[model samples]
Target: MSGTAHKADVRSGGQPGSVAVISSHVARGAVGNRAAVFAIETLGHPVIAVPTVLLPWHPGHGPATRIVHDNRQFAGFMADLAHGPFAGEIDAVLSGYLGDADQAAAIAASVAALRSVRPDLVYACDPVIGDESGLYVSGQVARAIAGTLVPVADLATPNRFELAWLSGRVLEDNEAIIDAARALGPPAVLVTSAFAAQPGMTGNLLVLRETAHLAEHAAFDRAPNGTGDLTAALFLAHLVNGRGHLEALRRATASVHDVLANTRARGADELTLAADAALLSEPVSDIDVRSVGRRSEDITIGG
Candidate 1:
């Protein structure tokens, strides 16, 4: 389904709190905006979705057409939203994959503009640069996000590889993840794919101002894309709903775990978010959350 089809199907109840989701849009799969928008809205938050690019499906599944908006037009579109009358309605902004490096500056500008009116706005930046396979995007695009967006983000959700790349170190353990997260400059950093204590589990290590937590769940084989996107959106949504940091982390992790398990059970190629929508609100997945204590001074900078 294209964004058009999604827009037609999703009908919010005119909710008060709305989230601005800026990412890619896939016609047939739930990857970027498709994943974030539905996850946010299902939790009762209205979504203002801005697509950085449009795709028929994720490139991982097969070759698909890519539709990137012209740089000037993209900037104008984002500017209109930022300066528009309803800009203040946005409670939070979650930015993901970018089509071009210039898009990072445009997003930063929009975030800044929104912050001027709503000083307490929560901006979560998901630097979707690459995974374990190394840098997937151009070095320029990665640098643009690191320079223009990451510094301003209230929260950053980066997988282990991304965190390692951003911090200029190899993160081999949770402690290293914590140290790098602290040095990364974001007030709060959610490091996904952190080392799991359990043999068959993976974790999301959340390092905040004064505390660190690890939320672990069973590791599924071949999990679909957009887990990070869904996790970031849900975590922010929970915070906006007044949940404490620990609660938000646990809930968000559980929701993603449940959704992934469901998707796998059905043998679906993409996340079955629509079928597992209820899990977003009432996730039944058992997430083991533990306090990992405060940051440690003994940090190892991996080679």
Candidate 2:
């Protein structure tokens, strides 16, 4: 969680805008900041990367040293950025994988400070708490994220398990997910690992007030980690570039699918994001997006 400033590449061209990404940093793996920063930069956006934690690689790969900064120092560091001269250059903030519960408050402070000057600032929170196995972080960290960061998020990217955990309900189907997402407080919610109508297919569900769109693609077994992180970054990038919600969802999903497929084909444990940078800019994978009618009960699985 230490604050180390990495200079943004001038080659990005900054066509859309700059994004401030707060997340974990792995030295070798394409997860957390490693995934988000590269994806955003590859898509032609300047990125200010704030690492919440530093690790040798994703813990799933093996044991690695984890470094978290002092809470007071982390707070000051975030405040510095919030009030810094370049703060106005940022168009959005995307956060993922907090190192500690206190870091959540620091992030919230940064978000608040930025929003004070730029009322329309976009903040995307990806609750990287856990997966189907259960919560990987302590209850305090989970609560901090749910109570602090999520409340201020303009958009939230939570997988099915996370959405269920955050909403405190069982989401056995898309209808349940949609209900929970609508009530999740964010204007838009992107639920990954969402239920799909057809077997062997997985979808990223984008739920808005009046409608829900499911972007489905072939599910890859043993997909690498950081797909959620990558999704949030790409989605935010597209939106900042003026793409609508549906288009952003489709493009993000397609890019993630393409990256995962490439990772699987290469037999790599992590997403080959660096090698496959073109996928982020122009994903070749086809994603089928369909509108689902709002429901009071269970949503129909198929049209």
Candidate 3:
């Protein structure tokens, strides 16, 4: 088993919100893990990471990352810690890409246990299933997340594809996506990789009980692998910090868009932390928090 710990100075006196991230740990590089750490740290939150497997690099259609020692044992290690130190301290649990359905079930069961201890603990589950093409998680895992985890989640961030899978809804436009989100029964649903009726534009949608707001940045020519992870991390952090779903969505959307912009400006394949981190604390520069509607007079894709 191999791992590395990089610590940052978290602000003192702020509410010490605790978050448990159940996702994979790639020893060398993973934008998702890094984004999760950065987002949580910015929010002055402590995090316990439960990894699926310790790998050298994140295996996907992205940049090559180095692999150190394998820490496949870390998953159980995290689970054990969850039973102990991660008891009442956990204010929120954020889950990302799981290796398989069994892992999803295990995560769901663990979440249930945590909830047993702290009934108010928020579970922000990002059902990392398939994307525009098809399903990525095992069928059993997909089913477990949709059936078990989602119904109990306080907040969920599912990409457009995952939303369709979880709700059995065909999201052709913004209206359909919002309806699908409502069907899932979560108070809030952050849908990434959202495509509107437009021919070639992709963005994110934040659907709440009363409002459905769409935040569209010009779709980057390339797809960044850990984007959803980053979005989920910040959104959860904001929500845990007392920001409502719509506010959190605006902030998260702006933060991710700024990160992508910085990444492109630097000609980097991955996010540019130096420039992007500045936006972490203040995700959206302008927004009317009172109203849950787009302020920029942008065209609604599917209403």
Residue pairs with clashing backbones, model 1: 1-27, 1-28
Could you give candidate 1's per-residue lDDT for residues 65-137 as a string of tens digits? 8889999999999999899998878788999999999999999999999989877778899999999988978
Q: Is candidate 1 or candidate 3 better by TM-score?
A: 1
Off by over 4 Å in 2: 1-16, 295-303
- lDDT minimum window of 10 residues, candidate 2: 1-10
Write down the TM-score for model 3.
0.80
lDDT of the candidates, in the order given: 0.86, 0.86, 0.69
Question: Highest lDDT among the candidates is held by which one?
Answer: 2
Model 3, stretches more than 4 Å misplaced? 1-15, 61-79, 195-201, 284-303
What TM-score does candidate 2 reach? 0.92
lDDT of 3 at 294: 32
The ten-residue window of minimal lDDT in model 1 covers 1-10
Candidate order (lDDT): 2, 1, 3
**Between which residue pairs do clashes occur in model 3?**
56-67, 101-141
TM-score of each: 0.92, 0.92, 0.80
lDDT by residue for model 2 over 25-79, one digit each (tens)?
A: 9999899999999998887788899999999999988898999989999999999
